[model samples]
Target chain A: MEIKTRQFKAVARQELNNPNSRIFLDLLPVVLSSLRQLAMASFPDPEAAQRLGGIIRAEALSRLPELLEQFEKNALKAGAKVFWAGDAHAANAYILELARNNQVDFVTKGKSMVTEEMGINEVLEKNGIEVYETDLGEFIAQLLKRPPFHIVGPAANVPPPEIRDIFIEKGIMENPTVDPRELGYAARLYLRDRFSRMKMGITGINFAVAETGTIINVENEGNIRFNKSSPKIQVSVMTLEKVIPNLKDAMHMLRLVSRNCTGQHIGAYASMDTGPRKKDEMDGPDELHIIILDNGRTRLYQNVKTRQALQCIRCGGCLNICPVFGIIGGFPYGWVYSGPMGQLLTPLLLGLSGCHDHIWACTGCGACKANCPAGIDHPRVLHYLREMEVQGEKSLDAVPPPFTEDMAYKAFSVIASNPTLWKLTSKIIRTVLNRNAQDGKLSKGPGPLETWLAGRDFPQMGDKTFHERWKEIENNPPKAVLEN
Target chain B: MKTVSLFVPCIVDLFLPDIGEAMARLLKRLGLSLVYHDAQTCCGQPAFHGGRNPEAVKLAKRFIEIFENDETIVCPSGSCVVMVKKHYPELLADDPAWLKRAQAVAERIFELSEFIVDIMGIADVGASFSGKVAYHESCQLSRELGVVEQPKTLIRAVNGTELVPLNGAAVCCGFGGHFSVTYADISEALVKEKAVHYIASKADLLVISEPGCFLNINGYLSRNHPEHKAMHIAEFLAGKQN
Candidate 1:
């Protein structure tokens, strides 16, 4: 509201005061349990739920190596070549190498956060190649020269009229009032040209089934289908985490990840491309490469607490449901993933110094935790991050240890151990607070009391302590007081 | 007839003392004994929301220390009642004495609606209210604690009141604890949406169990839609009796 406003504190305090916050907080357990039920169940049956949950937990960490070997097997069978990229840089180079190997300068790209993560466009464009973003939102964002603000609805912060304005500025649409459909058609026309002529198509895999070496691309606009089917050389750069054991689970994953991310039952395009189209196949790429990029994930998965991040289907439910992410927007995560999943994932992958604040800003309300299909306990991870933060701060020698506690924690530990001491302390604290009440109301809440008042009104901390009243009633019982 | 211990949440005690009285009177009518633990400053709802988690435990420990006897601790506010029923055990785990107290208390800590519906085992409490009333589902009560059905069930069980659904009926009414004040703009947006739903629902009386929801809906009704009437669930029930 003001320039000097402590936005984070203000936002946090405001969230704390919200009635919905309480409702949501209380509602969380039920929501969590029910969603857990949803995630566990493939058929919404008891056995399927347990079975699916068990499979995920058992082999979630070892997904990468299994995926590479599976890809080798499946791709070799399908007469396709596979490349391995140790990191994002190598992955970008490998994709660029594919483009160069094809003698290609123009490429059509689909919406891929992983591509953004790898800085594919920058690397390719700097090497004097043309990249066309085929997804409508991605196209607008590319035109605006900005990374996507949202994963699913990439420009949530950009109003429709503003987007119309952007479209007109780019001359993609002649009128400023370009309805979303017309603007989409414009991109379709432009991308159709790119699709027909482009030598190579680049995309990201939502999931790669190890059983078939099948790469699944989930898209609303069918650009992923075009990317997979049209290009002479198709390279889908994927993080190793996308690999699953088989196709049945891959279909089940599509069923959940789509609904969870888009609030729709299914995306329009859920095409599974296994290597370039075979000679027997009716349509698709001649040269197919599934670049399995490790990119520091192997090390991240080495630890248990951080590894569930690998389970992120990139559903973006964590962003949409997040109260903070809803307001501040997602570009601030400063990377491919944002919101609850990104915070945990990016820190482990990119290093904490860059994305530690992602963990710090979380309210730990567990909306992300509850909604996560993978049953990733985001808040628990956030709690882990918080403790790690305190430890890291100590390690950094930022704030001297003496100042972190205000005689309060020390006093609490001591009193908690001795009941007599705690009782004495509560009695004294109540007395001092009650004394401040002028008209049965303590208008000015003191010290730590101020944080409480940031969004609430506190009456003088009860004039008569509960203990005193309880004692009095017990000694000389009034009928109602005694009955209570 | 079941004997229920009444936990009058701190907010009800101070701001809406009458609700506390109504809850007591309502329970008495049901042949239940009301035991007011006067020493109860709070269920540590404030401390928990403030993230003074240990202090919240401190407050809870003191509560268990003072009221270590056997009785069902039923609080009127879902906010505090949930804290007692659920979080209390997590807080007192290290101390067995306190843990036992927490476990015993949690088993009995019921929100007023829950106590009336489940323990009292009556959907309709022979209560009737006049006017078109749409109930706001407090997040904690509905989502966190899973009491969404109880209040609606009771409202339906009541004869006179027409139960109407608000738009995004399950959406937060911007009473995200401290959210109403801190992110006033967005909070105000959420409030306005709820108010618009109320207008569309054409409910003359808006009933909510939560004090925080009561305040936000009141503010929205005052500043924007001044014509709509709102009353807490306790106030509504009390008014019916009156």
Candidate 2:
């Protein structure tokens, strides 16, 4: 939640050195990709599913204002209150006010990135209200006091030994146990009391149906279901783009969301909430509130190139497949979102200048684009962000050019246009680099080449240019080479 | 009777001329006459990826003017061919006249393996190599260009050559031009992971089509694991030393 994205280099270095994270990152993608491929095979046409997902999100975004109003009216009619927050500050203040007004001491929270984006836990704690993360991963992350490593499995990368120690320190376990089942039991025992005593609960809405004021939360664990149904006061928070036109569209999108998010045909729980308890109902929340937070999304929506980022279902598929995240994990992203989606959204939300560090980390491999169920072209969006940084757009003046990359590119273009000039430049660079070469390759380089030479060798340029060889080949062509 | 003009990438021109020479030899052996346009140098990918649109535009236009007339244009590098086929239209999108030329010239460009297998209809190339060879799928050729099968088919045709499968073959080797140098740690980390899988395959040679992957993988192999080797597909099929 805190903006430490500018420290990507340092964070990446730390992550790369941590062998624990590397082992987890390396194994997870292989397992997840296979699971996803298998789950996706069940669809008659996977591309069609992705296209439908993209189309539904695009339609929602095209008429966002109307859909939000429709959702508000329908929700109000269903006896649930709807509140609008323009940004993170307003979102945080409203939640804190709700807590204070009700004299609530402790609240249970389902996994919600929007809440993290608003820094609600810190705000609520500052106002003397305690918040408990009900999601298993989030609970572990809370115990460890670190940001979630992955979107779905936030503490999945964190080793069980470390978790055992955390549980022991937190007084939830009598002894350290490496077995994850024991840890789960420990967590369940600890959170069960909190669930029974908690007067208020909070959650994130995966999809909001506009036809009826219904919100859907899909999860493997049943924490969110309890967080919503067991508590008297319940609030579901979502960003503006989470709303869909109707239940049919919501169901259509859910098929891809579950499959893409964690490679599941269906999550164990799909808790759908319409409103509070009625006289006929046995048990439900007494109060239902939905907070739609903008927080820079409206600005992002105005830009055509960037609105594609909103289509993300937070599947974390891109993160699992991303080689960058495969090495560094999510901390370097410095926010709730990570991987391809984070690289695009972080800069848009945190301003390009400050968050431009991770934006440039993308290798333009297009793996994220290929894996995305939403059809978000992350490389294109990332390149657009880089271009914004290079051109020093009005919004990005605060982001100084990290290096003279533009100047080098300009020089490259000039040399590339004229073959004679290019020939001369290549010879000069090769000659200079050869002085440091050993065995036709420079094992250790000087100046800027040090980065490349840090681990791998730079192959020395050939003694003669291809042009020189081509001239000789032309003068004396190979005689009857092979069949010809 | 196909007349193929060779689009030698800037890196091939300077760093690895053997690849270009091998390509020329192989294409000639397949009975395709080759034309080398000396005016050609770079494909503007470095500038294009670096976000210098205006400068990349200049180089891209130069490429169009030089190669627009050639009916069949082939290059040893997948990255270069991708630049011409994919990004050129994007670069010159604002200029209709240039955009048309770029789009036209784009259809004419092909990577070496794809051209050999698809256009020339020659997968074997009447070549033989006796060893276990793992074909590293350069990102541009396999994922970006969708030429995944062409290279594999060619490799399988080589007599006595066992084509071993590579894990994460479609993943990047992290030789993203300036990316290797700018983000050296991440780049090195990636290439190291690549090397680990490559070694695990127990293949004597690692073959690739793109100049960048060739340079990066060979660079790592030559330094860390000197016994291992990586070669461009052109050089490997030509029975030439990589």
Candidate 3:
């Protein structure tokens, strides 16, 4: 996806500051932190955690291929048709064709990050099918026509009064009130009618089981259940990497996923099945379709340092702890996922153009890496990505324009290789910049460093380097040592 | 006793020469033979991090030439020591000779606190300071280098210097090598958050190993909030001023 830099950030910034996000995040931190504390408190012993973590990793990795196959089988078994998309354009075309096939005049979708990346809504809407976002947070974002600032908490930055204002304008709510529960209930009621009647329901998968070819959806709101169960034709869309080997793996992932995301032992519902509803079941769609998208996961899987990004359960721990992510917020990430995962995924999924603007944003602090259950060395991966950017290597997107940075790096190689030049630079620094007298401090400077001296008092440079100062003291000293 | 080589980081070589002298005196007092390699300039941190690979490799090879025979290499800066241990191998991947040398360099490199604890086997340096001192754990040193408790252990040796734990001890202070300028807005916010924690702790001095964090948090607090002051660990210990 070729994204214009400032335009993309503007959409993100607007979404973050939007009322829904403020309300959501303000309320979310208290809930999230409390839940995290509870989760940590209830955590199994270290030995048990290690065992569970191992199983989870094995479950996800082993089931990847078989899950793809099973999902294909179940999707085909359902009365609804399925399509294979190797890339973004293919997925968009496939969804477009599916809309045309269903004769879908209007489609209602729960927030699917996968679809957002594929530009599915835009594609379907451009083809004259009206797309309505049914998720509460999503509905708010759509009212203003912007991308979500967060993956799970689309409305994290939005506060209640502004949301009430937006709702008042959109004619969803009667007036502003201080109650969030009532607000959530209002959104639930408003979205229910569309959920019941939409011809097709679109949803993203939390996990796809390879054993039974089942797609599992985790939700607290019951909207997902409605999206999956109520529509005549339900289309489950997921990135190919979502596949897991079996039921056991799916359960293990669920343990971490539920706890990490919302601080539950499990989400309220873990709706699971390989195909359409069972013969005995009265509820659930008659036809169930699943579309698995590659979107560059295969390429990413081949790299060692980065492949662990797939192991993300979409838990946002890294974001909460990340100083950059916490302070700057998510919009600057320029894509669906944010924080550590985005730094890894954006480059691999959308390519370098979107990634470079961010890949450097990381401080190599390893907060994300430490907190990550998958043990992804996020800072290391970020550093490697930056290296890839500098080398003009095109894993994705355009190699930076030759005029952009090649000359600077070329000059660096020449300057670094020569001892004399290196010595000269150091000499100039010591003579001009380091010439000083007070308790080892630089009193003044010129050129680029003039600004540095403007506010903060400068530290003095030593007349001779430590090694030189030491060598002179021991070798031939009537010399007054630079006293400590 | 084992012989040790000193790799005073390039910045210390130029700016904080007293820290180097203090370290040398402290080591000499401890009775270990010291080899100071003059040929050493940098651990190739700036060049390697900047993606000038060949230059970094050339410097690494030069480093190996200068200090290949030393039994152990110690540096006061956790950040540079980590860079040398981690990034050096990537720099010399195509060359087997340098790869072996790179691994050898990594195997022996130690941060000052770790060298004191592991090599010297001394929990506290018989030093003294008065008033409250909050230790700032630089991320690379504490996390990557796993030297979290070393500074605390050393601080306990000093009489009258009470160690106060800084809030959000594990969070970065936004001194991520080019991160300070690249994401200045976030960096400023992070530093301010840290300053609040410092002020709340009501400590007389903030002690740190990594210069980046020292300058960043110190710079922010000194300018905007004058009630607090920051000092690097070396300066704090060597200055002997509470």
Candidate 4:
């Protein structure tokens, strides 16, 4: 995928102006969040259930190496081929080679963000191998050549009229209809043909259970099940963090992810593949290959602060509650991941320098943190990322913040730490800010305040600041007291 | 009478000192002795949010040194209290002495409503507003500090002030310190929606606990819908009218 993370502000502004995007953005969070609230009510203790999900993710990430090894060993024992790819290039190359060796003209894919991260479809297409996105939303997103608007619904924000136009253009539908069901049936029929004829299928592993050496994929549309069952050769790609200690943990995560993602008790299909089809089996893949991709995750795990990001189960819960994501949708994130997840992951995967806008475009609202099922402290992580960006990190390819900002903060620190300097500076700042004031309000201003003043009015700095008035207020009873 | 040290945040100190005065007035009426630490400047929120950790550390130490000895501390801004109570310890983690002080100060500090309703066990502060009012839950105060019910309790206690429902009241008003300016467009969108909700609630006044939120929401209301008013909880509870 093209990296447009640097265009965050431009894209975000564009999204904000888009009325079509606004309708979806407003409805998505409210609907999904309320549904999530209802679904979570099923738990005896929702908070504890959420906390346990966090614990599971933390444990899995902390014991990541051991869990990955155990998963590989068990997967190999179960007659599945396991390949470890250090990066996206390696992962894509392995998948491309596998497709070529199988003599397959095309491969059907079950919605996999990791595959998008690896740019697998682009690679396969460039190599003349057709790749069909079996997931209905993903199929629309792919045909439209756009990034996923939301994690759960790639084309969810894309309006029906737009989908109808794209479906017609892609020859998926003969009749032009804005109805979602009709569009969906057209996609199903189109994808179904590919599913039946495809020799190879690729999917993303939701949970790679080390206890049973089974790879699990959960989906509502049954496309992932078909991807697992119809093909002779099946390839499942997983990030190392996907490996859990046991099936019980996987079940626990399934409960969390389902409720958090789409507010479902459970996805329609929870297909698990231990390995290839047995000799006695009538159907299922003849070859089962699992590729474990690192792709900057190992480096992310090296730092204690960054490692917490790996705990995310990609439930899109954060997106549903994030005010920033609610306003701008997903395109501004300019990568495979969007919302708080994108803010946390993109900076780590893509260098901080390139992802400057992506990281800083948050309100530091803890809604994402409070809502995350995986227990990722997004605001804290974002703060850490901001620190790294300001200070610069060699390993992460981060450059130090601009000289002006650096100096501004330095001056701010000096003034803020000393009361006398603070008072003096406050007076100077007040006079300058109030220069254009009318009726004790500055309707517009220059510099950083320009943007704020564009849409809102700022109060003129108080004539008598709190510090200056304390002496008088202390000696006299409060007005409320005097009134009584 | 319990003595409460006032940690007036920089925003309240400069932009909205009325909030600080209101807080002082409300506390004084409740029979709490208020001590204003004039030497205190900031809680290092701007520096911390700007990723200037060293500068934030300096300000944090300054804050700790000034208020560490107080029996109890209260502030009008939840985000500032969060800065001292939550981020300060993490920022000072490398320095044991400062971290210890930060942790101690963290416990002693409380947001105004939290201090009044929770610690002081006084919900009715002898305040009243004869109109329907909706409370805007600031992000850090509500979620980070979990100080939701305390402010609402105080609002409900006010004579004739109906605590009306505010749709998406807990959603951010988008004054994320520097975020309002840097990502101004997105911030504007959010604050606009907040104003929309506030207007739709038909509440005579919208009350907020945090001054940052007050500046943002009131700033928008001032420009776009000058008639629609929002007040800090301090001012509202202090019986000050907009």
| Most accurate candidate by lDDT | 4
Measured against the true structure, the TM-scores of the candidates, in listed sequence, are: 0.77, 0.97, 0.89, 0.98
Instruction: Report model 2's TM-score to 2 decimal places.
Output: 0.97
Superposition error at A3 for model 3 (Å): 3.2
lDDT over C-alpha atoms for residue A194 of model 3: 69
**What lDDT does model 3 reach?**
0.71
On residues A39-127, what C-alpha lDDT tens digit does candidate 2 reach at each position?
98899998788787888888888888899889999999999988999998998888888888998999999998888888999898888
lDDT measured at residue A6 in model 4 versus the true structure, 0 to 100: 88
Q: Score each candidate by Cα lDDT.
A: 0.67, 0.86, 0.71, 0.90
* Backbone N/Cα/C clashes per model: 43, 0, 20, 0
The superposed Cα distance between candidate 1 and the true structure at residue A303, in angstroms, equals: 4.8
Task: Please give the range of 10 consecutive residues that has the lowest summed lDDT in model 2 chain B.
Answer: B233-242
DockQ of predicted candidate 3? 0.47
DockQ top scorer: 4
- Model 2's alpha-carbon lDDT is 0.86
Per-residue error for A204 in candidate 2, Å, reads 0.9
Model 2 pairs whose backbones collide? none
Winner on DockQ between 3 and 4 is 4
In model 4, how large is the Cα lDDT of residue A266?
Answer: 87
